[model samples]
Each structure stands twice: as C-alpha cells, then as structure tokens.
Target: MTKLIHVAAAAIFNPEGQVLLALRSKQQHQGGLWEFPGGKVEANESVLEALSRELDEELDIQIDHAATRPLIQVPYHYPDKSVLLDVYKVSGFSGVPHGAEGQPLEWVDIANLEQYDFPAANTPIVNALLLPQCIAITGNANGTAEYVKKSVAAISGGAQWLMLRAHQLSSSERTALARQIRATIDAADGVVLSLNGSVAEANDCGVNALHLSSDKLMVLNTRTEFRGRWLSASCHTIEQLEKAVSLGLDFVTLSPVKTTATHPEQPAMGWQAFSELVNAYPLPVYALGGMTAEDVDQSCQSGGQGICAIREYW
Candidate 1:
C-alpha cells in the first residue's frame, strides 16, 4: 500500500471573501500549480496544530484557531506520492500574509478560482469554497402556486442556492414546477436553482442543476449527461457518499443529521458522528434534516459544506 502523507492546509479568507492561494515553487512537487497554503504534518502534531504551525512558518501570520472551520480532506494519489490533505477555512487571523518561503501568494475571488490552474485534487476544495453555506429546499407545498410563492420568498429572504423538491408530483408536474422556480430565480439575478429529478427531467425543465436521490446515486457509475449543469446527490452512509464522489458530483446532502418529525424512527447521526463520517471525504457535504440557517456555522465546524433544509430554510 502507498503510504499516505498527511498535510494540513488553510483556505485563508479575507473579509472580501477572496481566498488566499500560493503558487507552488517549481522545484517542489506539483510545481507551478496553485495550492492552498500548507505543508506536511509532523508525526507528533495534531491537524490543527500543524495547520497553525504551517501558516506561521509559511505565511508569517498567526491563525485564530477558534475561528477555524473544518473544510474537506482530500486524498489524492500521484505517480510518486499520495497525500491526505486536511483543509480548514481560516476566517479570523492576525497579521498580513506574505510569502515567507519565497513562493508567490495571491488573493483570488472564489468565483474566479477556476481561471487559475490548480492540482486536480484541489477541484473539490474550490467547489466547496464557492458554494453557498445554506441551500434552501422546497418542501411539500400545498400546490404549484404555493410552491412558487415559497420559492420566491426563499430567494428574497437570502437563499442564493435552492433545490426544488416535490417527489410526490408526477414527472410533468415536477418539471413544470422546476421551470417555474427557475424562472423566478433567474429574475432574481444571482440565485442558483437545482431541480430534484432525473437528468432527462432537468434537461426538459431547463434547470441549472440536478439533485439525485440516494437510490439513484448508488446505481450510477458515472456522472449524468447534463452538460454545463451542476450535479448533486442525497447521501446517508459513507458508502453512498463514496458513490457520489466517484461519480464526481459537485456536492451532496447527508440527511437526518438530526431527528425530524417526518422520520422520528430513523436514528439521528449527532454532530459528532456526522463529523466523523465526513472527516476526510473530498466532496462537499450539506447537513440536511431538521436544519436551519442558524446551523450554518455549526455545520461547517463539523466538516460540512453547509446546512440544507426545507421548512426551516423556506
């Protein structure tokens, strides 16, 4: 087995939401590529300790550990080495960051990160950083009219990302609802709309993204044929999450993090277990089930991309 080298990295963010990235030295491994500022973890140090040390050594800045939120841990295999990157979002820090090791540093807007060349393993990290912290899901509204009204309200109330979910509706009915919601969101100028349906339905409805059910996710061997559309999936167990990652879905929603009225009998995976489950998986994960907008920080702390909710978010 290839031994995994553990690395601690920080996605240091300025107040403007731009992430700090460093240009790798040509002499080093993965040379000339842009990467998050970090280094290999020493044998005896904790991930957090290593992150703090690496920032201080590489950037000459003091990291505020309290403000550090767990992001994603990606395991990537190279021809000569394998690395398990433990990444964190550093929202609070002291001192201006400058490259102390002679590597160049730049603050790039999250949306424009794709314009820069990054290692293949850094792709999911970029996605997680760019995605919204709250994903509002449309609940069981009484009718199409009610659903449209709620969708508009959700967007107006600051939901930049939304998932139109009406599993009980027929294919045509779901497609129509998705189209209606997409129209409303587009008019709002910046909100992203993801429809909860099949690839064919999403294409027919002209939606911007597709959210697959866990069942559908498990059966897929590759990504769907929706070109230019973002793909996401619902996940429960680590097996489902692995499947979603293998399919290269943009993100995933891990459900029932907390017990809900809809499924009182289904066991709730408390925050601790949720954190453990998503600890090192690369794909961004949204904590779903009985979540509210207020849980966003806690979700991030627990290694989730954000919180996804229906009633509470709407």
Candidate 2:
C-alpha cells in the first residue's frame, strides 16, 4: 500500500511560450521522466516559500522576482507512496536555469511537451501547457469573415491563437461564422481556433479547442469528455479557477493583468499583485488583459502560463 505525502511543484514558463521541465537525477525517485521543478513542502513553510527554496536548491538559481502561485493541489499515488502536490505557476526569475541538483532540464515549447512522458499526476498539467493564449476579435458587429481574416493575419503576424466571440449574435449566425473562421484556420496550418461557446458542438467541429464563458464554466461539472483537444476558460476569480480545475480544464485566464482601455472601469491587478493571488494555487494560468508578448517575461514572473492580450498582442 502507498502512503500519502505532500509536496509543492512549479510550472515555469518563459517569454517564448515555452515551459521548463526537469529530468530527475538517477539518484532520485522517478529518475527518468521529466517534471516541473519543485520538492516536498516543509512544515511551517508557506507553499510559495517552499517553492522558491526548492527551485533555488534544485536549479541553483535565485528566484530574484519569482511569482510562485498555487495552481492545482491534488493527490497522486506512485506504487509505494502518494503525494498531495502543490503546483504553482512560476512567472519570472533571473539567471540561467541549471540543475544545481545534478538533474537535466529542458525548456520545452508548448507544442513539444508531448514528446516527454510525465507522471500520471502531471498529465493534466502537461495538457494545460498546450492551451493557447487567445487573442479575441474585438469587433463582432462587423463582417465576421473580414474580422476573422484580420485576426488570422494577426495570427500570422505572431498571434498564435484566436477566439471568435460573436456574443450578441444568434446561435445560428455565430455558428455559421465560427465555422467559416474554423475552416480558415484549418487551411492556414498555423493558427489555432477556439469558439466562445457551444463546446458540445465545437467538439463535433474540427476546431483546435473550446473556450468556456465565465457563466458556462461556473455550472459545469465532470471532466470534459475530451482527449487530445485543448479546453480553456475565462476566470476572473479564484472560485472560477477551482471550478476549472475540477472540470479538468486545460488552462485558464486570469484577466486584466493590467488596467486597459478594453474595460476602463474594471481594476487591473497588475503583475505583482496577480502573482500573489496565483501563488495561492497551481494551475496553468495565462496573464490575460492588456498584455503583449513583451509582457511575457513579466507575466511568467507572476506564475502565468503566458500573456493573453487584446490591444497588446492583437
């Protein structure tokens, strides 16, 4: 029988939409497969404190300004023992990453993560890496195809993922246009597509993924009946992020990373404050709202998956 243990882990992403994975030394348990850099949480140490300490020891790098946000806290069993892992998104840090612990490490781009096998508990975490940082089309009132085309151009111009949010349109119209955009994305062989709603239908379609609305994400339950497809959500609160984890979401958006013209009245959490909130849990979190690729370095500092922008990247 396996005994349960508790530990903390970190999913560290870089500015180029890649994440850091470490290969344990031959002396360590689970010696071959790669893992996010972290270790068992010590008594009396806060999760973030433990994360910072572990990274410094294991990687031999100072966490000069790292945002170690709690992501998903889950229990996983290895044949001999089980562990309650405290996962965090490590947004930023200084110095080149070296395995001071004598382990090998790789900085993997999102698309390349599947190449390495990870522990079963970290499987969901791996999928989270594949989720896109959506750049939504700002104007739905205009012609759908034209707007979508522009979005595609933006995607070619470095925007990798997009969400077609025709919120006010009737379901049928939205579906029609979304389908067209889906085809366009497919033809391009580059950009990924996600629809705002109708996931059940989106599943039937060939689009790369589905983006759940805040309302829909709230009432959802059970892991989405999906495999090999990315699922994402818009989360403005901690509660929503929890629900997303429960629903087996691939990744989530922590929005308004900065105050933006998009939502003038809504207060932005800024990078530092958001990092603290994120430090509370471990999940693949994107720093959404008024962010750009330039903010990527900063966002990763806050434990973010990457930056999801409106005016910034788009």
Candidate 3:
C-alpha cells in the first residue's frame, strides 16, 4: 500500500461569506493552481492542531478553534504520491489575512470559485463548499397537488436543493410534480431540484439533477451518461460509497444517521459511524435519515456537507 501523506486544510471564510484561497508556488507540486490554505499534518499533532499551525504559518491568521468543523476529507492519488486531505471550515477567525509565506492570497465569492484552476484533489472540496447546507427530500404525499405544494413550501422555507422521492406516485404524476417544481425553481434564483428515480424518469421530467437509489447505484458498473448537471446517489456502506466515487458522482447521502420513525427497526449508525464512513471518500456527503434542519451544524461537525431530511425540512 502506498503511504498516505496526511494534510490538514482549511476553507477559511470571512464575514462576507467569501472563502480564502492561496496560489501554490510554481516551485511546488501542482504549481500555479489555487488551493485552500493548509499543510502537512505532523505525527504528533491532531488534524485540528495541524490546521491551526498551518494557517498561522501560511497566512498569519488565528482561527477560532471552537468555530472550526470538519468539512470534507479527500483522498487523491497521483502517479507518484497519495494524500489524504483533512479539511475543515474555519468560520471564526481573527486576522487581516495576508501571504505570510509570500504566496498571493485572494478571498473569492463561492459562486466564482470555478473560474480558477485547482488541483484534482481539490475538486470535491469545491463541490462540498458549493452545496447548500440544508437539503429537503420529499416524503409521502397524496398526489401531485400535495407534492407540488409541499415542494414549494420547502423552497420557500430555504431548501434550495430539493430531492423529489415520490416512489408512490405514477411516472406521469412524478413528472407533473417535477415540472411544477422546476418552474418554481426557475423563478427563484439558485434553487435546484433533483429526482430520486431512474434515468428514464429523469428524462421524462427533464430536470437538471438526478439522484439514484442505493440499489440503482450498486447495479451500475460505470457512470452512464446523463443529461443532467448533478449526479448523486444513496449510499449505506463504504462499498456503496466507493462505487459512487468510482462513478464520479457530484455528491451522496449516507443514511440511518439516527433511527427514523419509518425505519425504526433498522439500527441507527449514529454520528460516529457516519463520520467514519464519510472520511473514506472524497465525495460530499449529506447526513440522511432522521435528520432535521437544526442538525445541520452537527452534520457539518461530523464531516458532512449538511442535513438532508424529509419531514422537518419544510
């Protein structure tokens, strides 16, 4: 096995909601690329400890340790090296940030981050940052009317990322609901709606984001081309997560973080297991099953993008 080089990185943000980035020195590996500021984790130091030290050394900033939370862990392999990037969100910090090490620093709007070049390992980090902290998944609904009404409520209640999971509805019903929701999203800026169904269904709906069930995820040997901007999956185990990553998915939802009323018999994985599983891959993960809007911070603390809930979402 290749030895993993552990690196601690920070998605440092100012009060303006812009993230701080640094330009990698041309003399360094993956040079001329923009990267989140961080450095290697020493054997004696914890990831947080390393992150604080690295930020101080690199940018001369003091991060508020309490406000720091695990963001994402990325495992990337090059021809000659392997690295495990343990990243954190630094929400509270004290400093007028500068290039303490001579590298140029820039605070960029989250929307404009894609305009800059980044190393392959940093791709997932960008995606994680771009995703909304609260995701609303539609649960049981009586008909297209209820689904549309509930979906609109979710969007109004601040769920920009909505997943329509109406398995009980007919294909045509689902399409109707999707079209209505899509129109609503179109009128509102930055709202996204994804379908948790088959490609055929997605095509019929003509939506831009598609989410696959775990069963569908395991059946695919490779990522089939889809006419969508975002592709995500439902994952329960490390194996499922591996497949999702292999498919180059945009993100995934790992379930049973807590026992739900619907699946009360199924043992909950709890937060520790969820965190452990999320660390295995680079894909942005959302804590699903028994999640509520209030659980977003806890989810982020456990290395998740945010909470994805059905009932308490809207």
Q: Which structure is stronger by TM-score: 2 or 3?
A: 3
TM-scores, one per candidate: 0.92, 0.67, 0.93
| Model 3 worst lDDT run, 10 consecutive residues | 220-229
CA lDDT scores, all candidates in order: 0.87, 0.71, 0.89
Note each model's CA RMSD in angstroms.
1.9, 6.0, 1.8
2-38, model 1: which lDDT tens digit per residue? Answer: 9999999989999998999999989888899999999
The order by descending lDDT is 3, 1, 2
Off by over 4 Å in 1: none
Superposed by TM-score, candidate 3 places the C-alpha of residue 219 at a distance from the truth, in angstroms, of: 2.9
Q: Judged by lDDT relative to the true structure, which candidate is superior, 1 or 2?
A: 1
lDDT of 3 by residue, 48-161 (tens): 899999999988889999988888999888888999999998999998899998999999999999999999999999999889888889887776677778888888888888
Q: Which model scores highest in lDDT?
A: 3
Question: For candidate 3, what is the lDDT?
Answer: 0.89
